[model samples]
Target: MISQFFVLSQRGDNIVFRDYRSEVAKKKDGQEEAPPVFNVDGVNYFHVKVVGLLFVATTRVNVSPSLVLELLQRIARVIKDYLGVLSEDSLRKNFVLVYELLDEVIDFGYVQTTSTEVLKSYVLNEPIVVDAARLQPLGPAAIFMQGTKRMPETAVTKSVVANEPGGRKREEIFVDIIEKISVTFSSSGYILTSEIDGTIQMKSYLSRNPEIRLALNEDLSIGRGGGSIYDYRSLSGSGVVILDDCNFHESVRLDSFDMDRALSLVPPDDEFPKRDNLKLK
Candidate 1:
């Protein structure tokens, strides 16, 4: 769980700060805060520097510290993708949308949703006029201020407005499977070591929440239509590309794949690598 979140500038200035904890224990009886720097006595911090900003998250309890850093990295990417860059000026200019985004990305230190496509659907690229009607609820239980929400009186580009429906377009998807093979030979032309690396990348422009499944064969041979059909036992004597210890994208359903060896997923808009590397020895 996240206890506190902060965005500081290169000069160590607080750009934006959010606290998930309802009450902050004072350093002493009357002290309003701890030392502003990341290193306080007991608080554990995980921060990453990105684009002239110090993205920091503080946690009072023991938790996976790397998760906070990962969340911050994703937030940086989302902001950069939506606002063009991740600078103090951009943060100030688009503070409204930034706040809205942070609320959507995380809630009470638990990751809510970091899907850029879904976020982009609601978060536009222009300025927003925060109003009762424009500030749409992300969902019944998504990013919202606990007590009350007051949008900052900051100006974004007038062209970018939230809750606009122009982004709803029919999408086209493309999939690419890449493999690289390298072999080393001795002076007598005797093979020393040969290795293969493979990756599956899919570019999806489909509408929101589309489930996709991509299946491949062990022998890397095409049978009927666009499919790979092979018998592993028969191919044991021959050569076949078997993906071992494969790593998948977050959109992939690992449980389903574990059950039937089918690559099932909800593809993001950008080209997502379905597997990290299919190594061959």
Candidate 2:
């Protein structure tokens, strides 16, 4: 069971702390209780560090030591996605997001969703960036609906050359299809085996819970091309892409994928990566 969670700076100052139990936060007379010493006689403390901040989870019960450690790493990733950077000042400035994420990840010291991709589905807000010309940083709640912080004027012009003057380019997410082709050949050059391993990597900045449909030319049949609905005639007629041994993020509903023949997703917000893998013959 988890007793407390803390985000400590490199110097060990508490950037943010939360007590999961009510008694830990209050005294017998109901006055506020002081912070617990990180090292207690019987408790075990697990720590994970990322980008100069330490994430600590303390517990008194018997639990998988590795599990608590993994939780800290996942928590840090989700926070990094939200804040774009992790540091003493960044966590301090974005304390609310940290608290909100910690609550969503662990319920009363039990591990909940450790998938940062899934966690991003619940955590909506992102850190604020401001006008670059003035080089002034805005307050944390300031929303930026336009493109990312200023690119070089030349780079910006190059990106939107097709747009009419003064038309800003839409900030669309980028999806990367990475494939590693595996092939074998005898010294005589006769092919023995071949397969394709691939993954779809997405860097998203869409609106809250944006639904996406990814259409590919892959010939998809519940069974095989022998199915009357997708017979050899049709398979040979249209250019068909073939996929084998595919996998998807847990958020992807199998029923929808089967019905639509499209990869469906509610994409995560800015800079979060969603990866799905597949093998093709």
Candidate 3:
């Protein structure tokens, strides 16, 4: 069976996460200014959490839809292979959850692309295996399965030449894998705060319960090979903040932004007051 895949890009303003309930007032000139946000230098730091995945399936075959199922199965196999560390039963359950979640995302206006040539089909594979007793009988179980037939080969046209010789662009395999299990994944994120700034913020997949926290006060310095503070002066005010919790239990991997690599973000004078400047203005 032939499978057509497309990659998802983190592009456009259409896919935005705005949780505000109340609308901000617009200026009389009709220009709405962006709301207050922290500036990391010149750019705003936006935290990203995986809401869900979206699958846009377009049937290119003129007569058969067998490949769509094959494509979905391939996606499921990849996810199960790479991310299946749980028990057999739990793995299966989460695989199904991914299917259901992607379905829900597609239904909730996630796929806003306008491609009339291809018909859109939403498959929510969220099976109610858990709490099965809570499910009410909508009708006869066999009757509900009536419409899910494999598309016949007669319905599709056979091997028509593409108008463009290059054909369509190929999608990234990871994106489809993400979309395939989008419904089932729950993100485990953490709140990161700086002691010097008293700032609190959250980030997905960063670990709420870290395995370690290294407090780097003024004059205190650390690095992999005992690098000196003068060697790190090029880093500016950025410093590392470490937390020791089970979540981030991995060995120290420091860079320009992390704790082991540089000095604390506090200004040097503020931390160690100069003797000449000790005289109050």
Best-fitting candidate, measured by TM-score? 1
- Candidate 2 regions exceeding 4 Å error are 10-13, 21-41, 100-171, 176-199, 208-210, 216-246, 253-262, 268-281
Candidate 2 per-residue C-alpha lDDT over 19-70 given as tens digits, one digit per residue, 9 for 90 to 100: 8864333222223332322344566667877766778777777677787777
Candidate 2 has what TM-score?
Answer: 0.49
lDDT of each: 0.63, 0.59, 0.26
Model 3 bad stretches (over 4 Å)? 1-56, 59-95, 108-208, 211-259, 262-281
In model 2, pairs of residues that clash are: none
Q: Is candidate 1 or candidate 2 better by lDDT?
A: 1
- Quality of model 2 by C-alpha lDDT: 0.59
Using alpha carbons, what is the TM-score of model 1? 0.50
The total number of steric clashes, by the backbone 3 Å criterion, in model 2 comes to 0
Would you list the rank order by lDDT, best first? 1, 2, 3
Error of 2 at 184 (Å): 16
- Cα miss at 55, model 2 (Å)? 1.9
User: Which one wins on lDDT?
Assistant: 1
For residues 45-133, what per-residue lDDT tens digits would candidate 1 score against the true structure? 67888966878777777777667778888888777545544568778887887888888877887788877677766654463332222
Q: In terms of lDDT, which candidate is stronger, 2 or 3? A: 2
Clashing pairs in 1: 126-160, 127-157, 127-160
